[model samples]
Target: MGRLRHPGRYRDERRPERACRGRADRLLALLSGLAPYVDARFSLLCHSYGSVVCAHAAPLLAQTGVQVSDIVNLASPGLDVSTVGELGTSARVWVAQAASDRIGWVPNVRVFGVGHGRDPLDPAFGARAVDVDDAQGHDGYLVAGTSSVRRLTAIAVGTGDAHSVLAAR
Candidate 1:
């Protein structure tokens, strides 16, 4: 999996919403370069700001014939895209947000281009929600022994149903 980083440190608290268009373009280029070498369809697991980049790159990736099997968003701040269907791909969309995650308090709405947009975990956002009850906060989803990690692992490896794993939690 490729990890993306913004060019500059987004430290300005006043402008919490850093422009992600450039980052998205970089991600597109990275994925395009990887497409030829990758043999099987892959899943995208994005966390926080990375989800914003995924949202922006989804359509572009489809246009390039990238085979995306699934997209898992963990503690996403927000997504600029209006609908999951607008992602322009056949990938199954999954989302998880811990109750204790501070990012959950971020407004789901976009204003002055500040916020990304709607919460992917919202029922109306059309994504399958995974249980993260055992997660502590924004960064806890991947912690070892957590139910979130187990479900996420299942989703990543395509061995078990993520919803079923969550149900057992």
Candidate 2:
């Protein structure tokens, strides 16, 4: 539900797995609707549960010919998948979790299909990791004046990688 050019927020405190699935469907539709207006592939920047929506929609987007160049997840508990291969997309996947963020303690497990899967930052999850040790907290990834924002911007624009991008500047 996120486009790199624009960012938005969603609130769903009473979250449930069933509701998330519905949101993923809607997100898929919205992206599909906007695909025609884009001159290039989509780069999704998602945080928290929004990462779950992106993860669910990514493979569907691929099947429907929506070219997604990158997906960057911030403070994500899980993407509902144990590994990148389970995501079923060719887009480069990135995950950033601040060291002080408490979400790291959340177990990436599915109890009767009601939980997010493996922690996205887990080494076995296979996403390009973004170092956000300087971020203030879980919600600070996109906050202006943070180092993570700079690295994230570079990745989204496809001009750089996580480590070398800012150094080249």
Candidate 3:
């Protein structure tokens, strides 16, 4: 799954999960249609609230036979799941957040049943940490000259391994 045009801003405040869940549903239909063309499971690279959309969609993709190889969550506020096990996929889960990114300050709790959930960066959360020390801020992962982009690119193309990708604290 490549980057999707999210259309507008991130999650909706009125009913966040419903919105992301709806997107996930739509994502399933899209992937279902593309399933015939996919020779192997594909990977996903998501950032910010987009990660929320992915978190909702990941497991459902498997039911539709659109297996995912990997999931890279970048500077996310939350993934709506407390554990990688909850994602229900064999795909490797990776997390990346810059040392200076303010997203680290977001409370790792859900509110009104629709807020951010577990901190994907938390070692206990079980996502493979990706080094982004070269990243300056939340959106800096893809910025030029950052080690984040280099590693992300490799992961996208299937070259980087968990052992080679830099680890974040």
TM-score per candidate, chains pooled = 0.84, 0.83, 0.86
Comparing 1 and 3 by lDDT, which wins?
Answer: 3
Q: lDDT for model 2, please.
A: 0.75
Reference-based TM-score, model 3: 0.86
What is the per-residue lDDT of model 2 for residues 1-169, given as tens digits with 9 covering 90 to 100?
3432111233443455545667778878887777678757778888777788778787887755567889988878788888999988899998888878888888888887567878877778888887666787767887788777878888888875645432211
Each model's C-alpha lDDT?
A: 0.76, 0.75, 0.81
Any residue pairs clashing in model 3, and if so which? 131-166
- Candidate No. with top lDDT: 3
lDDT of 2 at 76: 84
Q: Which should have the higher TM-score, number 1 or number 2?
A: 1
Q: Rank the candidates by TM-score, best first.
A: 3, 1, 2
Better of 2 and 3 by lDDT: 3
Worst lDDT run of 10 residues, candidate 1, spans: 160-169
